[model samples]
Target chain A: MLIDVTDAGDPRLVDYVGLRDAQLRRPEVSRFIAEGVKIIERAFAAGCTPRSLLLQPRWLPGLRELIDAWPDVPVYLASEALIEHVSGFHVHRGALGSFDRPQETGWDELLGGRRLIVCEDTVDHANLGAIIRVAAGLGWDGVLVSPGSADPLYRRAVKASMGSSLALPWRRMASDSDLQRLRDAGFTLVASTLAPGAVDLAGLEPPAKAALLLGTEGQGLSDAWSAAADRHVTIPMAAGVDSLNVATAAAILAYALRP
Target chain B: MLIDVTDAGDPRLVDYVGLRDAQLRRPEVSRFIAEGVKIIERAFAAGCTPRSLLLQPRWLPGLRELIDAWPDVPVYLASEALIEHVSGFHVHRGALGSFDRPQETGWDELLGGRRLIVCEDTVDHANLGAIIRVAAGLGWDGVLVSPGSADPLYRRAVKASMGSSLALPWRRMASDSDLQRLRDAGFTLVASTLAPGAVDLAGLEPPAKAALLLGTEGQGLSDAWSAAADRHVTIPMAAGVDSLNVATAAAILAYALRP
Candidate 1:
């Protein structure tokens, strides 16, 4: 169904209203907004059901084939100015898709993976997304984010992940004690920490199954989480410098420890 | 010189005028703004000459001792609203400093280092800054960005670097032929490319002196730069995924190839 929407207040455009607001970031939100052409394509490729699409006419010709595949999906055509007005930001890449949230990966499926990234309160959307991207790109089987972490399917995260958050099997942990379950599953819990006596990452021989636990931005892995790890590893950094950003650190660790 | 500045148009704040403008991003710009208290402290630590400071009243006490040490440098106290008005953006970090651009690292000093990051048109400020941060944190000696790359001293880059840019020795290339100079210095030119048959980063033995080449966001390395490299290296990513972000790639390479 192709609908031309002239009014920014159109009730049908509800999915895209106030995109910059906090509502869309909530984990309970039923739909995720896929921004730009590439992410929208990835959303479809990941088998997400498209609820609707809001885009300018110039974006139509390129995306025509993709949208035509879903004939029942409403394609709301609007002007570039109206889109900027409706979304409360410039739709610079010039397309947006609202899709039903994909089902979360199950614990059994997640535990079967050889390698995983387990994030603790890694709440920054872009950083979390980058972690997911690197994890998937390097052939890591899945991601397990803490309860307080940002939603992987959120627009900013999806954009940042280049939609790898959709491609990878990620599940939000119910509680911190999930670490116990991982340990019981025959996986080595390696915590990235600054604690003295931590082994250098280069020297460590990675085990058959390992979960790399990353922490939030300011405070590193919480003391309890740090204590629970089977081993502690540190990237030996130069003197007088602060630690690398969490996402960058994840990339280095993921590359070095890839199964 | 403790001066309370009320008017946003005060002549003392000239270095901060229209901060969002392209002028501040230009390599020719004489001064750079250091946002937040930590980076300001880093600016002083890096021996950058403080031209002046624009900050809120609440922040004065904590920074008093540091500012008092440089009595000749004028401290412009203003309301957060006033600072935000002048800077054309909210100074949520609550402080700012205008510092005379530090002297660029010379070729002789840079070439003497065993590990270096050479960026080719890595123009995004935040990405370039992250590269510098990772390079420094991983103990890479210096950074050499191509002529077209963003200035390492640009405000956004400096902030993203978490003040590592202040501590690291980074210089911009005079021309494309600077790669030749690096090769002449006996530094192995390792190009991070996606090309087939590129040596997997896991297997390659990094030479003593190596300069890793990184490119821009949308495009990978330019053909000429890739061809000029002494060896091509790649992170073996999983099938069906786009490549890693430039900054993330830099982090992995800097760590793996660290001296």
Candidate 2:
């Protein structure tokens, strides 16, 4: 199963190149490329099967058991130099794998009897991944991403999440219909904003079923989202400072309201 | 006085060269380099004076007003090619500044009505900076770094903070003695941990005068520090996930407990 490959143009590796946004429209096309041993192992531990793997010849010994564990998957081998050439960057981790992205869950299914984070237009992949990592660590049940958000399956996101993005229950809001569906599911929308009229984050009593809504970097939550929310809360900051990173803000808000 | 220098090792730019730990520790090191225009401007706005400004000649027209405002600071000129070489990297931002690091603040004075974030062993500059940025935005009073923490004045920390590190009140705690002094004061020490019998993060109400303590990346709270704390709280996480980034965790905890 460990076949050696030298050509970057190999038809099998087509799914690996610039694979970030290819499946934005069709979430089914989402393929996760987990690099490094720890991430790959975690992905498998999370019940994800590697569709294929690319490894440096030197790592063959270390990866033998893992490869043996996945006998059905095509384990491609190449020289370290060839891997560096094909990857177009120095991959010190010595290995990479392609895995099918996990399936999505409905808002009610994901949010039932648990805390949830709603990230609105968080377009940065690293921030998205970091938020997921925090959510996983802070006991949040799941994450709901707006359509304008970045693909969470990006290599940077997966690596940044430390592989938790794969394991965490998350789904993209397919459309405004999806957002409306979430609103109708009895989840109290807590939109985070810094406007004068907003209540202090700590001042609010915890809701029974809640979604902590975060926003983009510069522009905060959209008026429509704020209008739809049951409450608007602000993390009181110094007079001159702007806002915290959306992920950091979400982590704090989610933790504050954790069920 | 604009001087154009072609050499990377020009003595006039000594403060801006190969920025390592030793260089940052020098007592005579008055000026820290700011990479982007926003950070440089923020430093100036916070009443920190710039010793000199460096920029690609192409930026001359756009930054005329800002340059004119800083009448006392010497501006150095370089071509796009020369600027990149001198900085040892690409200068896409087209501007940089050398500003004086401010004097330290007394712990008591910094603690006055300020929601202080006390970082124990967070030695990562990027995380330190991000935490500062969040602290500033969330209306925290100041930040205190323990013995093993990274220098906030480091170049990367300054960049990551988006310049808010310069604006926020900050100081370093050289040892356990300094932490003891903080306890001698009436500051509540809320150390974050994953240990059994710890209070849940959400349940622990914010104290009027409090300092939120964060630990290192892999290791949770140290036994000595955890014992010293007035209260120990854990951010409830899912069973399988490892942990959150130290800074993200800090941000969340800080915001949740902010006054």
Candidate 3:
């Protein structure tokens, strides 16, 4: 169903309001707003069903087939200015899709993979997204993010990943027991840390099935995860420099340890 | 020289106005603004002479010694609200410093080292900064940026690098001849690209002196640079994934090829 929305305050456009406000954009509500034409297309490509779409008419021809596929879905047409007004920022890419958030990847499927990235409390959405992109790009099979980690489906995260978050396999760990579950599935947990006495990353030979564990931005891997790791690795740094950005570090590690 | 300015429009406060506006913030005007307490301290530690400082009174005692060292420099004290009003953003970090932009690193000095990162038109300040941070952290000696690259001294870039931009040695290339100069100076130019037939990054044994060249966000590298490289290298990726973020790619290359 195609609906023309002239009023920015339309009640049906609530899903698109204040898109830039982090607190208002909730991915946990079983929905996420996919911004930009490319990202919206990626969401659909990833098999995410769109609840609705708000877009300028200029984008209609390009997205016509996708819209036709979901004839029952409401496609709200509006001018660029009105959509910008409704979203609290310029929707410069000219389209937005409200997607039903995909279900979490099952633990058995995630852990059954040969390569995995396990993020512990990685709170920055961009960082989490970048991690996902690199992990997927380097052929890592899946990602396991701790409960406190930022939602990969968040707009910024999705945008930063260049929509890889939609295509990659990932799940949020319910608790610390998830770490044990990974170990029980034959993963050799390798913690990326800055702690002294850890073997240099370049020297280590990863196992056939391995999970690279990364921690939050400031404080590194938790003491429990660090101690529990089958091995600890550090990327040697020039004196006085603290560390690389968490995602940058993940990319380097993923590339170095790729199976 | 201690000063208290109540008005945000004070002509003396021009350097601090519109701090968040990229077009308005020009480090090329012989000065750069350093935000937050730690970055300000790092600026001073890196020997950047302070022209002036706009900061909350609460931060004065913490920076007393450094401020005292440059008694001739104006220290403009303002409430956080006033500073935020002038800068057009929350001055939550409680301080900002206008410092003399340091002199460019000499070509001979930048190329003298064995390991280097050369960025060609790397326009994203944060990516450029992260590349610098990783290069420095991984013990790479210096960075060489093409004329079109973003300024490493940009506030966001400096902040993104965790202030490593201050301490790392970097210089802008004067021309394409500058790259030729590196080759003449016994450096192997390794271009990071997604082009076919490129040697996998892991397969190459980096020469004693190596320069890893990275390009802009969308495009991998320029034709001239790619053709001129002694070796073309790639971090192999899964099919269907376009590319890794340039900074992330740089981190992986820097770590893998660290001398």
- Tell me which of candidates 2 and 3 scores higher on TM-score: 3
Q: Alpha carbon lDDT of residue B113, candidate 1?
A: 93
lDDT of 3 by residue, A81-189 (tens): 9999999988866799998888888877887799999999888888998999999899999898888888888888988898888889999888877888878989999
Stretches > 4 Å off in candidate 3: A24-27, B24-27
TM-score of each: 0.98, 0.85, 0.95
| Residue A84 lDDT in candidate 2 | 68
TM-score of candidate 3 to 2 decimals: 0.95
**DockQ, all candidates in order:** 0.90, 0.67, 0.89
* lDDT (10s digit) by residue, model 3, range B163-211: 7888899998888778889999999999999999999987999888999
Q: What is the full ranking by TM-score, best candidate first?
A: 1, 3, 2
Q: Model 2 shows how many backbone clashes?
A: 4
Docking class of 3: high
Candidate with more favorable, higher TM-score: 1 or 2: 1
Q: Give the alpha carbon lDDT tens digit for every residue of A100-157 in model 1.
A: 9989999899899889999999889999999999999999999999998999999999
Report RMSD (Å) for each prediction in the order shown. Answer: 1.2, 3.8, 1.8
Higher-DockQ candidate of 1 and 3:
1
